[model samples]
Every structure is written in C-alpha cells, then in structure tokens.
Target: MANEIAGLVVIVTGASAGIGRATAVSLAKLGANVVVTGRRAERLTALVDDLADFPGRRLVVPGDIQDEQLAQELVNRAVAEFGRLDVLVNNAGLGHHSALAEMPLADVRTILDTNVIGLLAVTQTAVAHMKAQGSGQIINVSSIVGQRPFPHNGIYSASKTAVNFITRTLRMELRPYNITVSLVYPGLTATEFGQAKLGQSGGNRFGLQGIPAQRVGDAIVKAVRYGRTEVYVTLFDWLFTHINRLFPQSIDWILTRRS
Candidate 1:
C-alpha cells in the first residue's frame, strides 16, 4: 500500500522538544506537511530548519498552548497554510511532581491548564475544521501514569487520566464526522520533562531507564497510520496497563511500597 502519511497535513503541539519534536520529524520524513507549535520560537525554528531536507513543508507557530487564542490561531494557521488538516497531535503538556497536599495551587492550575484545558482547546478548534472536511485523526499523548498514578506524580497522572476520558468521548462524538481519536501512553520517556517539572523532580522513581522520546514518536506515527485506538511504546507498556486493570489492589500495594 502507498504511504498514508505522505501528503497528509499534521499539526503537532509542544513540537519544540522531546516527543513532539521527534514526532514532527518522523512525519516530515515520511512526506507529511507538518505544522509545529511551542512556546519557544527559536526551538521551533530550529526544528523547521533541521527538516529542511525533507519533502514535506514545515510551518512554525510559536506560542504557549495554554492560551485559548493560541489554540485558535494554531489551527487556523495550519488550515490556512496546508489547505487541510488530516491529523492533530495533542502532545503539548506540563508535568508536576509535588504531593497533592504539598503542591502549590498555582502549580496544579498550570498543569491542568496545559494538559487538559489547553489540549481540549486545540482539539475543539481542530474538530471544527475536521468536521467541515469530514475526516481527521486526533492523537493524544497521555502517560502510563494516567492508568497507575505514582505517589509523587499524582497530579500529573490525574491530568492524563482526564485526557484518557476526553479522548474516549471525542472518539465517540466525532465518529459521525469520520474523525478518529487515539491515545498514546508513553512509559517514562527520556526527555527534559523531569527537569522541567513544576516541583521536586521524582527522578526516575520507577527504578528503570526511560525509553527514548523517538520511540514514543514512532508509535504515534504508527497510531496515525493504523488508526490504533491505544498506542504504547513497548509491549511492557501494554502489559502494564492490562495487568494494572486485572490486579488493581495488588498494583496499589506495589506502588505503596515504591512510595
């Protein structure tokens, strides 16, 4: 079969670094027009420059994802530039590490604003256009923590859990419009995410090294091509989710010990 990714227009939020950046690169290499957005103008420009040799066009729209206005403008620019939008990668998000009781209220708001509210904003905007076109795909970047919340990272996990629900609902609501929504659960990713977290860094409490962001990015590309409802970076990630579902109390006991 011909490459489905080639000639599609994709918008990736948080494309300045880590999984978002890697995903943009992966899609561009496969001949997809990519619109990358993030808070850092320089980083987004660099991303576009790095992909100069790729066949697909690149557009950079640098702004904070939390701004509702930015969400509108981002999608507007993508549609205006590319003429159509085939995919939206809601990869932009914030991370928090402090305990629920100890975390500052400001920190909690920040996390929710980006991970949940901001993601919804972009999704809504993209859906409007996608509905007009009668087809599109939405790939939400969630985390394994969403299913099994770690002690210190409960807040972040909660935000991702919300994403899980939102993605599921969108999948059903947008079905008539022919828009598919998928979720990507990345187990610990080796990125600047920890260092940039809002509170004390948990610093790999899982006792295992993180997988590369590129691995997660590749899984996202696969999700788009295959229309997989749930994408995991590894077999272990898939098993972990299913196992947690089967033995919730047992997993809770294990997590308590880790804490």
Candidate 2:
C-alpha cells in the first residue's frame, strides 16, 4: 500500500490485451492489487509474465464476464484474492461491425450481450458490495462511437452508446452512497481488439484516428487517482466530441463523406 493506488483492489475485464491489459499494468504499478479477467488463460498468463514486477498484487481470473453468474463470480474471486474490492473496470466487450442491411441479428445480439448486458450485470453486482462499503468506483469503457454513430457499425455504436447512458445514470444513482461511476470513451488506439473482434472495422472506413492505447491507460490511471465523471483521452477527440454535440448536422455530413 505504498504506491499511489496501493490500497485499492481493482478488477479489469478483457485483461488479455489492449486497454484492459494496459490498465491492469498501470494500476499494478500504482500498488493496487489488480485482478484481471478474460477468456484466454494463456494470454492472461502472458500478461502476468509481462508485468512480472508490478508494485501491487496481481491475480488472473480467466472467464467470460458476459455471463451473469460469471460476473458475480468475478467479484467473489477478486475479494477472495485481494481481501476487498475498491474499483471495477468493466472493459470486457466485443465489437460487431457491418452495414445494417448486411448485419446479422445474431452479430448485433452478440455485441449487446458483451458490451451492454455484461457491463450492466457486473456493475449491478458491484453496486451491492460498493453500497455496503459506502464507497467504490466503477469505470465503464465505451468508445467514440458511443457519441458518434459510425457507418457499417450501427450495432457496436449502439452498444457503447448504451454504456455512455448507463454510466451517467449510475453516477447519479450512486452519488449518495459515495460510489463514483465514470465513463471512458477511447476514440481510437493501437489495439488488436478492433480487427480481432469486429468483423468489419471502422479503421478502414474511417481513416486515421486517435493515439496509442497507453494514452487511454493513462486516462484510466488518472480516473483511479482522482475520480472523474467522464474522461476523453485525447484532446482533439474531446474537442470533436463537443463539436459534434453542438453541430450534429455538419458532423453527420462529414461522417457520411468519410464512410
């Protein structure tokens, strides 16, 4: 408990790679006992190998967070490993992309299952314990698409958009209990997640995007250090998100041209 985040026990899903993995490492460096969950046991082991000297405690729980039973089990595993839970990073998500016309209902359902439903289940489960403790933080990972509707990725966009709305609402609901809810919208970053998860990607359709995954990881670190309601990792992205809000028509036209 000597590091910045020393005393907190944080759970990060989708921890096999990308933002989730980066977050686990970052939090660990800060002395937070971190529990990483993902489906791939090998990748989780590799992650532990990479962060061999983390300042804080590290545990890996390989499982699908999309299941309700698994979500509760995730919290149980964290408490069992770390003694208590102080933060829950809901980063386990899947992306689905395709033109609405070409999109299969099954693919869209999968996106909702992983992104929205799973997130809700985990958050709900965390709330019970956080409410009892009277303090905690829940960081929900969303995307730029949560704010801007992307072409050929209607389903993915909607799923993250739901995260945006839900996180905000939970923030208000949990405020009295001293529970902090935050939404992190990472525009674009160097993560194999996009290509590996979503069949059709926005990178090709929407040209060059945001910065590295560490930038988002840095933002997560900031959120953990000083609780925030919402955070946009990149300055330009933060600017554009605001701009899109005020000038929806122009942004829509720009997106149409780009797509």
Kindly give the number of clashing pairs for every candidate: 0, 0
TM-score for model 2?
A: 0.94
Candidate 2, residue 166: lDDT: 95
| Candidates' C-alpha lDDT | 0.92, 0.84
| lDDT by residue for model 1 (27-138), tens | 9999999999999999999999999999989999999988899989999999999899999999998888777898889898999999999999999999999999999999
Taking all chains together, the TM-score of candidate 1 against the true structure is 0.97
User: Over 4 Å off in model 2, which ranges?
Assistant: 1-3, 201-203
lDDT of 1 at 209: 86
Displacement of the residue 10 alpha carbon in candidate 1, Å: 0.3
lDDT of 2 by residue, 90-118 (tens): 98878776788877788877889899998
Clashes of 1: 0
Give candidate 1 regions above 4 Å deviation. Answer: 1-3
The candidate scoring highest on lDDT is 1
